[model samples]
Target: MTDKPNESSEPTPPRTQPVVSGQAAPSPYDSPTGEIPVVKSGAGENVPRTEDELGLDPEVPGVGERTEPIANRPAEEPTEPVTPAYAFASIPPAPAAGEGGLRRRGDYRRGTLDLGLLGLRLVVGLTFLYHGLQKLAGWFHGPGLDQTRAMLEQGGWKHGELSTAMLSVAEVGGGALIVLGLATPLAAGAVLASITDAWLWKQGMAPGFQYKPVELESILVGLAATLILTGPGRLSFDRNRGWATRPMWGSVTALVLALIAAAASWIYLHGGNPFTGFFD
Candidate 1:
């Protein structure tokens, strides 16, 4: 009773505990063993292992189960190679002769000038042949031999008859020979003589060069001379036979004949006549 002391009336004091230094408070992320719990986010959260990673035999089926990785599979095999549609390639081997014999290591050339000569020959020959037919058949506006003779007389050709005959023969015979690739040099020389004579008589000295002799006949004479100097080439019939390959004496004879013809034409055109001094 000694002042059972208003125990109920006394205020309860707060309980105090001893404090330890450097000790941190426990968090919800802390584990019982003091290790932090790892919570991965995004694609890395629930990735699976493959058969090779799990040490399973790849050859055995169903013996070991594994979650297959989507990216771990091998890529699809590529399709076989194919030739293009526009390609002109052939599978069969080309013929041996088609290659023009076996080319030596240093002998092959990517381009050639010989083909140009062949092309020229073909074009000129065909043109002359067509011209000959025009004269023969009167297909175009070309004059016949008789009318050509009259024109030659008007041009002061004293022997107009003979000149006309020779021109007709050269045009028809030489053109045919050229087209056939036979006696190419002779045919070219004949055509050259006729054309040269025509230029000198009709076009060269004419007033104002009305017919354009220097422009047109110069190119014609050059082409004809080129053909005369160079043989028709390997693709021609002359090469197939041994006849066209004549001795140097043949060329010398042709040269002499050409000089004489040219001199005769000059005398007829400008010098009146070689034998007579009177002008036409």
Candidate 2:
């Protein structure tokens, strides 16, 4: 017998579709679009598509759907433009005082200065108020208006009642306004004019314009001028006002007018310039 190869012992070729009489056999990698086929490793398993697979063009095989990278997709554009972080940050954040910021450096010092100014205002205002009440209503063992008028007349005031009334009004109205810090410049000016006249009156009564007799009046005049120049500070009704923050030309003008009124009162009403006596 011829030694022919046994059919059961020979290796079998891979199973494939039969070729037509004049056509080539189709390959496992060949598809209708002429692109290579994709074989997933985990067959029948729900394997998530990779970024490359997700980016494939639906119309074209083996091509990306978008020109941009998978990370920069058009579907994520709406959320990219939206910045939720700044939705509630309308105003810029400000550092608090004492936190090493230049803007808030003097906040604590300013607060202490305002408090000191408030205490000074209270003391000066209450003193003037007490004296005003004494003259107007004779409260606190003070001379009544009638007695004040007589005293002014005896002291060479031609219009004693008018002088007493003007003094009372200046003390009461100016002191009250200064205490409340309302119309601070005007109130200080009124008090300054009256106090200036009182200081001059004392100077005229003393020998050779002595300072000892009118020391108290001088201090009061200085206090009134200080208020005119410095304003009522931040603890007053005038807080945030131009005069309170920056007492400039307007306060200077008020001081000038007050001094002029004082000199005029001494010249016209008293018939003598007490200011000229200072030189002697």
Candidate 3:
């Protein structure tokens, strides 16, 4: 042995630490203070390297940082779901028909409403009819056509003959139709137009002196409008017609047409503005 050393025992190579970014890597036993003591088994055999001997810091995890590996984390506890209270509630029943209750049947006051309409028609129709006859035939001590024509001319109405004719026909014919409840919407429209002219005239739109206390004309206009909207009722000739029981779109159309016609007649035939009064 002394004479010739064995090749394996000739010289052992030096162990070198791994280079990490040109710096020597620390050994597993390296610590901040120095090399850490290794734990051993009871038989004096070395135990597998613990975290303390591996040079890792023993600091606790901060907030938001994981304390354990994902595979080692405990499963979250399951929660019981809540249900809505109304889901099991009962529905309320509908109210029965009675006083202050829902009306589920036909109108019981139909007869009363029809009677009221009849009375309204009579008063309006007869009043207009009387006036119309007075102007046309000199009835009830009224001036006849010649006098009426003269009166129109004095009241700033041009085309006296045509104006007188139209006025007489609208009042007389329209009044008669309203009384009989025949073509009620047209009758109401005609009367409405005539009354509107009268209202304008009384307010001194024409050359005549302004009439004080125009309540009669105002009342007449309102009544005419009421009849137009309410229909003729079941007591008259127009009972079978739609306008008789239900004055809706057709009634509104008739009213608008009547108003247009009245405006046209006043402006064109009378040569006067309906909106302006004598003072204006």
Among all candidates shown, the one with the greatest lDDT? 3
Off by over 4 Å in 1: 1-114, 208-211, 240-256, 265-280
Higher-lDDT candidate of 1 and 3: 3
Q: lDDT tens string, model 1, 1-280?
A: 5855455766899888756679876667676677555655596673335576466656664646775565897787999989566567578656775364654323334255446657767766766666665555555787776777687677667787777777777767877776667888788778777767656665534544354545666676667666666556655678654323332556556545664676676676444432222232
| Residue lDDT tens for model 2, 1-280 | 5698656866898899766688776676666667544555666554445657566545463455446555776574444565457776789778766566764455445657778778778877877888899999999999989999998777666688778998999998988888999898888898889889888887876557578989999999999898888878889999978888568999999999999988787776665645455335
What TM-score does each of the candidates earn?
Answer: 0.50, 0.63, 0.59
Best by TM-score: 2
lDDT of 3 at 43: 100
Worst 10 residues of 1 by lDDT: 271-280
Q: Give the Å shift of residue 267 in candidate 2.
A: 2.1
Q: lDDT at 119 for candidate 3?
A: 98
Give lDDT per model, in order: 0.63, 0.80, 0.83
Worst 10 residues of 3 by lDDT: 99-108
Task: Indicate whether candidate 2 or candidate 3 has the larger lDDT.
Answer: 3
Error of 2 at 138 (Å): 0.7
